[model samples]
Target: MEITPIPAPQIDLLLYHIQHHPAVLDDKTKHLITTMFQKMQDITNHGDDERRELWIPADRGTIEDFGDFEEYLTEGEVSSRDEFEELWLSEYPDSIKWYKLTTTIYENTCYVFLDNKLIFEVRPVLQNNDTKDHSELAEWLLSAVDNCLTALEKGEYNAFVADNLPYSKRIGKILREDFWRIFPEEKAAYLKDITPDEMNRFFNLIQTQPPDSPAKRLPEMTHRLFLDSCRLGYAANHYAGTNTLSSMELYRSHADGRDDGLLDINEDSPEDFAAWYHDERMRSGHPWEVCRGGNSTHISLYARCDNRGWWFTLAGSSYSRSVETVKFYLALNDHGIPAFLCDGQELAAMLAGKDYIGIVPGEVIPSYCGHLFPDENIIDFMHLPYDHTGAIIEAVTWHPLDRVTFS
Candidate 1:
C-alpha cells in the first residue's frame, strides 16, 4: 500500500494559525488537535503474503509544525512509535477508532485502514461570533481529506481521481469562501487555500487478526492455555466502539498494550495472544445438523455416549443484550462451531462444595466446580443459528457433557 502527497502548504498554514493566535486554545486539549499532530507513514509487507500494508501513525507527541521547533512534546519520552502510543495512552486510555475502506481492482480488492486518531483529532472549539459557530475551515479541512480518501476507494482509480481528485482543492475553495470572511487577520491569515498533490510511500502492515497469523501454530502448553481461556468463558465482547476484550476478556481485566498479550492466556509461544484468539470455537466435536439448516457442534467427551440431546437454552440477561454478546452466540452457532459456555454456576458450586471438576484459565491443576444442574438433569445443545448477526435471537443454547473428567 502506498500513501503520501500531504500538501506542505496546509501544514504551513495550520502552523501559522496556531502560532499567531494561541489564545483560542482551551483545556479541552483534545479539541485543539489540528496543529499539534504528527504524521508518520510507512510501507511494509507480510512475509509470503501477497498484500503489502501501509501504516499511518497518529498521536505523535513531538510534532514539527513549526520550522524552528517541535511542539506537543511530552515528558518521559518513549523511544519507539509503539512505545509512544502506549505511553500517551497510559495517562488517558481510550479505544482508538479504526475505519476500513474497501477498494476493488476488477477481480481483486484492496482495503484502506484509517484509524480516526491517525486521520485527525476532533475540533470542538467554537469561533467568536454572534452564533459562535464551528470553524468551517477546520471542519472542511478534515472532512475534505476524508472525502478524497474515500473517493479513492470506489471505482477506476484514475477515473475516480479525475472526478474526485483535488480533495484539498475543494477544501481550499471552502476556506476562501467560508472561513476567511469570519475571523480576524491573525486567524484568517492562516486559513490559506489548500494545496493538493499526489505522492507515494510504504508502511508496515499491522497484524489485523491473530488467528490467521503464523503465531497460531501452538505447542501443548499454548494449546492448553488457549483451551483454558475458552473454558473460562467471556462476558460478551465489550463492544462500546473501542473495546478489544473479545480476545478472552474473561481472563484479562482490560487489554492494555503495555502487558504482553500472550501472557493473558499463560502462553509462552512468544506470539501475541491476540493473534491466536480467533474467537472461533476451540474443541474436538461432532456437528449435529437440525431443522432450518442450523447445527450445533458437540464436545468430545471420552466414554460419553453420543445421544441426540435436548437443547439447553440460555437467555442473555438484560445486561447481556449487548451487540457483542449476541455476536458471540451467533459466531458459536456459525457452521456448528464448538464452544463451552459456562455460566460459572457449576464452578461456583464446585468451589463451594467440591462437586465437579473443570479446567480454568488460571488453574495449575484440574479443580472442582459447582454443579449447574442436579438430579441427574443435563442440558444439551440442540441447534443454533448458522449465520446470525444482528438477528434477534431469544437465547443462547448449550449442550451438556455426559460426565467431565479433569486433567
Candidate 2:
C-alpha cells in the first residue's frame, strides 16, 4: 500500500483517523494520539481558566475498557485524561509518537497526520507573500462542494465535507472572519490542509438504503418488514387507511367473495362504531370498533386510527398472547402501500375462508405502495417501544384514499 504525506492541521487529523480506527494504534500510541486530538478540538474559557474533563478510558481492549472519546466528557466522569495517560505510558513509555502534516499548494489539496509529529503548514506558492488574499480558501472549499454534488449525481451519495465544505458555506465564513477575532492567526495554516477530493469521496459512501428496498419472498413480508424496521411489535389487528402516500404492498385482502354471514362485520356505520367493536372483542381499555366480533370478516373494521398516520390493533388473549399475529388493514394514499395485517385468530379464519374472502387471488393487488421501513435516519426518530428489535413489517404508510382492489 502507498502511504501519503501528512497535511497541515496535523494533530487534528492524527486524532480523527486514530479514533476511528483504534485497532491500528497500540496501547501507548492510542493514549497520546487521543490526547493530542482532544487538545486541538478542545473548547477553552476566558483568560486561561481552562479546566475541562476529558473522557479518556483507564485501559484498552474490552468494551468496558474503551475510553471516553466524546467531546463533552464531564469533570465528574471516571478515568480523567491525566489518569488514563499514566496507565498508557506505564504500558509503553518508550513508544514515541510520530506524525506529520502538510499540503500541496499547487494542487490546492492537503493531507494531514504525515511522517509522524512535525506539523508543517503549506499554502499555494503566493504571487506576493507580502499580501494575503483569504479568498483562495473560499474557492478551494467551493471546489469541494461542487465535487460532492457531482458525486451524488453519479450514484455516489456518501461523499464527505472536509474543512473545505464542512465549514464551507456560512459556517466557514463565520469561522474565517469572526472566529479569527479571538485567534486571528489561525486561518493561514488551517485553511491549507482541507482534502477536498478525499473528503468528498468519503462522504459519498455514507448513503443509507431505505428499509423496504429489499426483496421480500414471503406472502405477507411487507408487514413483517415494517415492524422490524421500526423495531416494534406488529399489533395483531387489521388497521385501515387509504392509498395516498408511497408504500409497499405485502398481501392484499379484499371483500370480493360471497357473504355466508359466517364472519362478517358492519361496514356502513361510522368508523368509530367499527373501532368500538374491535376494542370490545380484544377487551382492551382503548375501545375501538374496527375488528369487531372477530374471526375473519370480509368487510369488518380490523383497526382504529385517527387522521395522524397512526394505526392501532388488538393485542390480547382473544388472539392468544403467545403467538404474535394481528388483524389489520393499512390506511393507504400517502404512499403506494397495501394493507396486510395479521391477528393470530383473525388470520387463521381469513386463511380458512380464503376462497370466500379475497386472498391473493393469484394476482397483484392494484395498490400504490412504498416501503414502510423508512430510511434508517427517519426510523431512528421513532420513539422507543416502537423502536423494538424484532422483524419489523407491521408498520403502515398513510394514503388519501381508502380502498384496495385485488386481482
Candidate 3:
C-alpha cells in the first residue's frame, strides 16, 4: 500500500516538540536533534529551497542510485532492492517506519525515532532552566572587573590572559609586554572609582590639546585614561564615559597641509575648527573617518543616563556588538535598569518616555545646542534632550531623580 506524505507543518511541529522535550539524550543524539531542528527553522523562516534540498533526501528509483549502499551490508552479502528494504526494516524498525510514514517530507525525521518510540519519550528527564538572575548577573560583572583590578595590582599578567571578558585580551597583552614601561602602580590606580564629572572634565581637557597632553602630571596618558574611562562604563552604573578622538590630532593630521576644501586649523578658532571637521566627517557617511587615528579608542559610547548606557567597541573597522556590550546590558537589566539595543529613533522615544509624540528629525531637536555633537545625527542627539532647547524636544527624561522635569 502507498503511504501519503506527512505535511511539512506537522513535521515541523513534531521536530519542535522533540527539540524542547525534557529528555536526557546522549551527545550524538542531542546534537542530531538540535541541528535538524535549527535547519528546519532556518528553511521555514528564510524560504531557501537550496538549503532545504541539502537536508531533504531525494527519491531513489533503483538500489544502484543509492551510492555506497553496499557498505552498510556485510561482506559478499549483496541483495535485491526488495531484500535490502526488508533488511533495513527488520534492523531499524522504528526509523524505517518513521521514514516510510513521512516519505521524505522532513530532514532527519527518522533519527528522532528509536525502538518504536520518539527519542524524547523514550529517555525523558527533568528540565532545569539555568537562567541567571539580576543579582547574579550583577555579581558576575563585578567579579570580572574586580579580578582584572586585582590582576593589575598584583602584576599578574596571566590572570588577565585567562579572563574571558572582552577587555582582558588587550589589557593582558599590554601588561605582559610593557608592565613597567607604561602601566606603573600609580597609573593602574586611575582605573578605580571614576565618576561622570571626572570623565566629562577629561574629555573637555583633551578636546583641543595635542595627543601628548598631560592630565594629572602624566605625559601621553591618553590610552591609559581611555582604559580608566571604560572600566567605569563597563560596570553599568550612574557613571558615563566616551572614547572620543582628539580634535587636536585631527587638526594636525588632516587640516594642516590639505588643499582640499576641508576646514583649516590656522584660520578658524579651535572650537570652529573642531566643529567643522566633525560635521564634514559625519556628513561623509564613513564612521571610520571620525573613529580612527591617534588616541581614539574606536569605542562608540552610544547613550547613557543615570541608570543605563549603550555603547559598543569596534573590532578594527567593523562594528560588533561585543561580548562586553552584552554583559553590560545583561547586568543592567538584572539590576532593574532597562537596557536596550535599538536604533536612534527607538532610543529617542525611550528617552522621551511613554507620552513622546513628534517627528524625529524635523519636529524634535536637541535641547543642548553644542557645536561638536559627537554621535549626533539630524534624527536624534546622543545626549539628553532637555526642555530649554525647544518645546517639542522637552519631555520627562531619564536623568537623575532629583532633577526637575520641564512640563
Off by over 4 Å in 2: 1-25, 45-266, 271-407
RMSD of candidates 1 onward, in order: 28.1, 26.4, 26.4
Cα lDDT tens digits, model 3, 116-146, are 2333321233234333122221222223333
Tens digits of per-residue lDDT for model 1, 230-294: 32223223323223434434333322222223334544552343344333442222211100111
**Candidate 1, which segments miss by more than 4 Å at Cα?**
1-74, 77-133, 136-313, 316-407
Best by lDDT: 3
* Per-candidate count of clashing residue pairs (backbone under 3 Å): 14, 94, 0
How do the predictions measure up, each by TM-score?
0.17, 0.16, 0.17
Q: Write the per-residue lDDT of candidate 2 for residues 113-190, one digit (tens) a residue.
A: 232222222222322323322222223222333333344345342322111111001100011132223343543443
In order, candidate lDDTs are: 0.26, 0.26, 0.29
Backbone clashes in candidate 2 total: 94
